[model samples]
Target chain A: MRSQSRIAFYLLLTPLVLWLGLLIVIPHIDMLLISLRERISFGVYDRSLLQYEKALTEPLYLRTFARTAVMSILATAITLIIAFPVAYYIAKMAKGRLQQVLFLLCLIPFYVSELVRTFGWMILLRETGIVSNLLQWTGLADQPVELLYTDATMMVGLVYTSMLFMVVPLVTTLESLDDSVIEAGYDLGGNGFSVLREIIIPHAMPGIVSGCIVVFMLSLGNYLTPTMLGGKDSLWFTEMIYNQFIVRSNWELGAAFGFMLLVLSSVIVWGMLALTGRTLKETMG
Target chain B: MIPTIPTSRAFRLTYGAYVALFFLYLALPLTVVAVFAFNDSQFPSLPWDGFTWAWFFGTERPQIGVFHERGILRAVGTSAFVAGCVAVLSVAVGTTNAFLFNRYEFRGKGLLYVLMLLPLVIPGIVLGISILIFSSTLANGIWDLAQMDIQALRPGLLLVILGQFSFITTIATLVISARLQKFDRTLEEAALNLGADRLTAVRTITLPFLAPAMVGAVVVAFLMSFENFNTTLMLVGSDAPLTIAMFDRLKEGSTPLLNAVSLLLMLGSSLLALLVILFQRRP
Candidate 1:
């Protein structure tokens, strides 16, 4: 029996080992190596730190990185604000079929491609789009307003895209809480707001932390939303990395940028783990 | 039950209104896309010229009406194939891992579990670009050793599948693992005690229990792979997937056909989900 268990364990470990080695470890090693290398003309990578040095000193790349950080922070804040109430409602208020349906509604967006969703935003926010046209007719604006191609529009897209991620884990954690605990708090003379503040929020801390980590990471790494919505002038960090690699053919600089973003994400994940006193396995799995 | 204050009718109405407004916000984009699918205008937006099926069925030559575009159809086919392959492969690997992890205790177990999950937290752009670079480098080395003529290893179907599978498999494993945790270990123990071998006990007792979760994981995995854009954008070869194709067209400008495609995709996925739910609820 012990031998059989050992065999089973080894079998389970094999796929994970193979996946990590091939996908994560190897790719990262290659990226690191390339980051140390030089780039030839026409986007071909040659063997030097010239690109990294240049990227580090360049004001454009620095500015873009700072802008991405600010945008990601703001988007994360907005997503949390919108998602918390809905998650609270679903977790504490809704039950049975209604809960299932509401949860499914949150997930349905996952089925649609991001491209399509963003396009929908484009149609809604364009000069002759619904929002703009409505604003014009209502005399909110003299003419159709230009709402597209701005940071605000980009934030709208990011928050909308990532809200589900925040809501799901929050719901799951909140659902696991004992309703009687809240009832007890009320029985002991706590008001609704006080119960929520002292009991519910603390209990759901892990979920909130996990949700924030996810939203932040996704927002930081997101390139497409910022590019499509913010238009040509948008200098998102991911876009900068993309330009370095694809447009300028500077792999080392791109690698440096990629590494920076990676380290930042890892730090955030680590901070969340420390704060919540739980491992990634616990939160994610 | 503790006595609670009854919510007023006005409060209930306000809450209902809020919920309705939220749903409207969520559904508005989808509704617009679906409605514009029937629009006669070339553009997807308002001021409907007339109602027509010309976009759906018109074949004017290279371009086709709007719906008959060969590129869109080909991209859709490619996406389906790739997503299908990813789903099957991920489910197979994920289920096996789940069984192994759940059924037995062994050395390096925690480390292996962490390794499985690393892909989930990693950024998609980094994953995509790294995979592209690694694959090309490896392909170059293999070609040199074998002396085979293979040019440009970066963009292709294989890379896209690899890129997608890396993350999708994590999702599958996580889902299956959750299901496995709730499974009764006593059933397997009884089977083993009753003169059944490990494989047979697993085949009869465990596999049947895990089948639904495995199926659900496959569906979710397939959908994720199908809708994938960031990684696909980075790793896809010259040939575009449906998402990338739509993105390209949108970049040029909005067209009603893109909305048509979105509506079709939305309807198709919802129908599939409905079927799966019905099937699951049948027994």
Candidate 2:
């Protein structure tokens, strides 16, 4: 009977395993192989490391990579800074339906597609748009601003898009935190700020770190937000990979760029796990 | 609990201001989209001439003829069809996989779970491109064996469905798995001890317990597939999906029609979510 049940279990597992293997694992292996090859004309691979060498040594590619990393790191930092207070407020202060309402409001933006949200920012930040108009109306600027196609706008869109992902985990973790810990700190004669620093922040550190990692990963993989809001000059690293494949038709180079992204993201995931002292499985579980 | 400190009107006012300001920031864009949908103007962003349903109804006027572009509608239909198929397939596969994972212990179980979730963590662009390459190669090999000429298997609906199912199934599996963990095993054991086969036990005792979770998983999968832009963009054929269509239209310039679509989608999704919530609340 045990052997029969085991057979049934393996049978149930077969299709899903095959589906993932055929679509994900095998394709990833192909990408790895393609990354090692040379880019012949018309985007075909020519079985060499010529493309990888060029991608590694090219200043343009290197600069774009560094710029994307810095921008993603900054965006992650800004999101955490903004989200931490909101999560804390919701977890600690708000009660009952009000908390649910506020949390739902945070989730509403996520319900809409990212493309639409990014377009909303584009309209608001355009030269003749609301932000510029408001700045001019308030006498804060002498002229209408050109903030639309810049790193600042990209940062705004990235942070806005990723804010909910950061907040949800923080709120869940903070909700699980015992209020008595903070009360104990206070009973020990610690002030409000001191209690927050000594007790609440330490308890929430794991969530904070995981939230940052998620935001960073999403931001790094995000090509659409930067492309739409930052315009042609933005040329984010993923956008560069996109251009190589779609516009330039340089498959080998695109594969190399993709592999680099994979490696970078994997390293970030590993570093986050080490820092938080938890595996990915633990976090997801 | 710490006693509440009261009698600070200034601090309350400051907090209120901050909350209000952030709420406005969140709602401003959605408000713009909702309002412009009703504006009767040539350009989408300009002042409202009058209230009209010309964009939504597709009426023509001599001075400014109504834009009769059915591209968005067609793309919406295509996306709906693909998302529907993806939802069904993913839920079936995911539920089965979740049940298997939950009910069994085996060698390499840890590795299997990780492999299942790898697609979720990988970037969509990478997934789309890799799938494109792999599918094309597979199609070519099959064609070579058949000795028939075929167009390059670059992009199409099949690829889109396959691409979406890759990650969406994982999401369904995770959600259903969570629910399954809460299931009471003794009920199934009771059924089994009463001379029911394993299949009969599952059908009578276990499936009813899993029905609500299965519904939620299906809805989530459908929504995820519908709103998916990144993977869809990469894998879509010559025809665009609604999100892609709207994006292209925005690239040209903003229009109230886009706003019209946004309002419709928002209302639709809210209603759908409400229905699900109501269903879950049912005894």
Candidate 3:
């Protein structure tokens, strides 16, 4: 019986091992090796750090990398700020029916594709779009305002896209907080701000950290929102990676840029985890 | 619900307004997308044009409906096929992963578990390009060394499904494992002790218990695979999925037919979500 159970275990283990190893692990290692090489001639390569050097030195790539990191961080922060109160209202304020309805409403937009959502934003923000038309009708502008392609527009789209992720985690964590804890703070002469700062924030830290990590990763890696909304001047890092791989056919440089993105994003995540004193298991589980 | 602190009328009104504004923000863009699908004008944007069913049902030129657009319809079919294949593969493997993690105590389990979650943080674009490079290089190496051609390794629908599968399986495993963790081991043990063999016990007792989670995982996986853009964009070859098709069209500037497709996608996915919620409510 023990032997049989062991056999079953190994059988179950095989698929996971293959799935993770062949698909995730081996491919990444292959990418790393590819990133470490430079093309000396047609179909001939030499081991070098030229790709990394280019990524670090090229003004376009460097600025784009920094810009992407900063924008993603900003987007994460904005998403948290926007999501917190809504999550709070859902978790603590709303009654059962209202809570369910609101939660479902929160989930409705996410059911659609990101492309659709981004397109929706385009429809609302374009020069001939709804918001621009409303602005002109309201005399807010002299002529139709083109809002489709700007950093601010991109930021709004990113925040809109990532808010639900932040809200879900925040709601999960906030819902678990015992109400009496907050009541205790209030009863102990704590004002709303004090109660939130001292009790609620601490309780929601895990959710906040996890949500930030997810939102940041998503915003950093996002290709669509920035590209479509920000247009030609978007300067998104993923676009650079895309351009390298597809347009320039520089897989080696693309691999290096991709690796740098992986490493840097991981570092930021690790830093957040460390800063908040949370482990992966704690937040994820 | 009880308030943590006493709130003034002004504070209460302010909070209420904020909540209303939040929902409006969430709903407005989607509402615009759905509403504009019926717009009589050439564009998906405004001037409050008269409503028409042209984007969905019109067979006329210059206002071709989504159903009449062969490219969009074919792309939708392609997306559905890829999503279906990905859902099955992800859930099947994800179920195994859940069982592996929940049932066995093995060395390096923690490390393996962490590695499984690594895909969650990795950029989808990176996942796409890495797999592209790895597979193409392997295909090229095989061709050079053995003088044989392997088509599956190249960029295509198969690769797109594989690319989406890489991260999606992780999600499926997470969902299934959450359900499995709450399962009562004694039920399976009782079956084993009552003369049922292991396979029979799992099939009858354990499988039924996991059925809901597996089903939920399927819908989640299917939606994720369907909605996936970043990873699919890199891995897709000649055949474009719906997202890719929409993206290409949008780049060239499109009409309300795109909006029509968006509305349809929204309706389809909302129905799926409603079904999952209803399914989960069943005892």
Worst 10 residues of 1 chain B by lDDT: B1-10
- Put down candidate 3 lDDT per residue, A108-154, tens digits, no spaces: 89999999999989999999988998988899998989988899999
Q: What alpha-carbon RMSD in Å does predicted model 2 have with respect to the real structure?
A: 2.4
TM-scores of the candidates are 0.93, 0.94, 0.99
Q: Model 3: runs farther than 4 Å from truth?
A: B1-4
Model 1 scores a C-alpha lDDT of: 0.81
lDDT of 2 by residue, B122-215 (tens): 8888888888778776777778699764544668888888899998998889988988899999989999899999989989888888889889
- Could you give candidate 1's per-residue lDDT for residues B1-283 as a string of tens digits? 1124355678667766776776777777677777877787767776777887766787764224545788889999999999999999899889877876776666777887887888888889888888877887788788879976564566888889989999899899888888899998899999989999988998999888888888888888888899898788778888788888888888899777888788888877887777667766756
lDDT (0 to 1) per candidate: 0.81, 0.80, 0.93
lDDT of 2 by residue, A1-285 (tens): 888797888788887888888888999898888778864555455778887789879999988988888888899999998888778878877888999999888888777777767766766788866677788889999898878888888888898888888999999989988877777787789877898788888888878877887898889889779988886667798888888888897777888888888888888878878977887776665
Judge the docking of candidate 1 as incorrect, acceptable, medium or high. Answer: medium
**Candidate with more favorable, higher lDDT: 2 or 3:** 3
Candidate 2: docking tier = medium
* TM-score (0 to 1) for chain B of model 2: 0.91
Stretches off by above 4 angstroms in model 2 are A39-46, A139-143, B1-12, B61-68, B149-153
Clashing pairs in 3: none
Q: How are the candidates ranked when ordered by DockQ, highest leading? A: 3, 1, 2
Model 2's alpha-carbon lDDT is 0.80
